[model samples]
Target: MSHKNKKISSTPKHTIIKALEKAGGRPKAVTEAADTGSDSEDNSSPENLLTPKDVIAIVTKTIQSELRSIVSELRSEISELGSRTDVVENQLDVVSKHQQTTDTEIADLRAEFSTFKDQLEDLENRNRRNNIWIKNVPESISAEALPDYLEGLFLQMLPDLSKESLNLDRAHRALRPKPNPDQPPRDIIIRFHFFKTKERIMASARNAQSISYSGSHLQLYQDLAQSTLKKRRDLINVTKVLRNHSIKYKWGFPFQLIVSKDGRSHSVRTPEQGLDLLRRLHLIQDSDPSTSASPSQQKTSAPTPSWQKM
Candidate 1:
């Protein structure tokens, strides 16, 4: 017999005998009877030692053990799968909350951006109504010079008017004045950025009745009016007429301009006082009659107009 076959033949017989003995039985009797039915020519065959039933019983027990082990391993794998499922659910909840928070923050930023855009548009519209004027002045008149003159002169006209004056070497200017006899006066033009100051300039025009500015020095007031909306409109009617006239005035340093025949001398209000002479002749008109009258009557009984302050 081959070695491998012999070992296989002995394996079933040995397993059956061991199981039968443990049960208090003889595996040899069953094996010997089983071999007689198998029609074995050799009576010394190894199959005579055991029966098939005994072998089958041993294999059934072994199979049951293996099944139990497989069942236990399957239970352990199921438990691990349940734990993994819980972890996945927790991670999903966290991701969902984070996405909601991110969405809310994005919405807030969009609202803020909209508000900022509206404010920017409003500022741009307001700037359109404001204007600036400048004149190419002589080198002698330093940048600091005109600002001082404007501060002193305007302060006298409107003591309550709060304003800041500046004379930048390169101030922004616009050409909106009508063409006058001088074409474009190249002295200097001051500017006001805020539109509200325009009302103050208009008020100055109406209150300059007591002043007289020489024709040669008229550019100073004209430049001021052009810098603001309210004053520009008030001056438009006059500018149109003066632009058509062709007349030049003499110019010199100290300018030797007569501010008022009333003999009131002060740099604080010289320009306004001079404008009063040209525009509001009513101030000088009433004065001449009273002075021309008898000196005794003027002092004793002359009544003052409501326009003049005591």
Candidate 2:
């Protein structure tokens, strides 16, 4: 048929349009049918028209498109969540490291503070025990002169301490004893006191009878003097014996001695004796006296002295 004179196929248009209206008013089938079919053609046949399956397929496709869009959005949200989790993990790591560092710093500071506190305590202990505060003494004074001088000096200088008599002993009980076949001598030690003079004097006198002096005259001043020369010699001899026996003895710092029965019997070893004893003990070698080398002997018999080496 001539295109100008062709009749319009209103039947196919009507059928497709009716079918589209039943399927939620979709215009796709109507437009496609109108564009492809001629007015003279039998496009109205049911086989050529839109079917139930085609309508269902179109609906499914539309749903799939919407679902795909929703899936993309969900995927984006999941990716964002993952990123957020990573950030949280990083933050947690930073916090954990910071806590560890802070804890270490706290421990270091605590240790430093403990060290400072220990230093302070040591200073306080030293201040309490330091004997240098007693003043106006001669440099030339010997250890033997110290007890009497300091005792009188204390009475005169620090009278507020108490109006007490000072007692001095040249020989104390702690000294090493000398050994002699004729006389079994006792050890010598020196003692000094500020307040307990009578008790010390009595104790010294009582102990004097038991001790052997260098001479009988040395025993005459037993109450005033500490150990006699005989007793001191015996002490040195005993010290040698102890060395021979492979025993170690060390002189400790002079300490205050308080009698439990009476405070008046309290005494102290003069620092001079303490110093001398310490020096002497220091000179005592740890070597086996029976076998080991002696510095004195080595010095006398040096193959070559350091002076000769120079």
Candidate 3:
């Protein structure tokens, strides 16, 4: 085929004709004559062709339409994700608030329990104020005979005590099963009608060198709450150290052990504190064990002097 007759393909002819006119090298009459010949030829032929400018415009329009659809889909997805994030944040806030309220309620309950415990302890101590514990008295004495026996015992032990001054109220053993056949009976607990009478009895007991009934050695002690009794027991070693050193000391009410040395009194609450004080006074060696005194030793020991009433 001749070079002029060899036609382009895959492009519209008018597009090429317009491009030729815009290029201005081809005369306008020649471009118009080419367009007329192209229109007269078979329009369905593969040789029909378009210009580069037309191709660029068509591609740009198709790309723009696809981008618009993609953008619309992305916006919808983003809106749904934002709504889900807001719901999750709201749920987290509710959970945090509930945890705070639960913590506050637990704190309140703990405070209330502490207050109730203190009040209950106070009541227990108050109930024991006018009572005394007597040990080594024979279990043979019946409860009905206890008051009279105690009165007579007091009168004999305490020279200043009178029958009318005794003011006895009630007496009984500890609230527990009787001891085994081989073991001794429980201590007798006595309650006096008056605190003054009880105080007098305790003072007399303290001043006495020894107390006995039916050849059995008897001991007297204040009827204290179990907690207070345990605390006092813990102080037995401290008491022994003071006594061995001739250091004056006494047990104050509600579990305070007071030691007087060089005219200065030191109050001790725990066994550790007592041991510390004794170490400072050079009364007991550091290696000494702070074991409580045995029952027999405690009974035989002299009462602590300079007792103070609280």
Best by lDDT: 3
Better of 2 and 3 by TM-score: 3
RMSD of each: 28.5, 24.8, 17.3
TM-score of each: 0.31, 0.31, 0.54
The candidate 3 region of ten consecutive residues with least summed lDDT is: 301-310
TM accuracy, model 3:
0.54
- Quantify all predictions' global Cα lDDT against the true fold: 0.45, 0.44, 0.71
- Summarize candidate 1's per-residue lDDT along 138-178 as a digit string, tens digits: 33444456566555555665677765532223332243544
List, residue by residue over 186-256, the lDDT tens digit for candidate 2: 43333444325533443354455443222222232222112222323334533454455554543222222
How do the candidates rank by lDDT, highest first? 3, 1, 2
Mark the regions of model 3 whose C-alpha exceeds 4 Å error after superposition.
1-122, 284-310
Between the candidate structures 1 and 3, which one is better when assessed by lDDT?
3
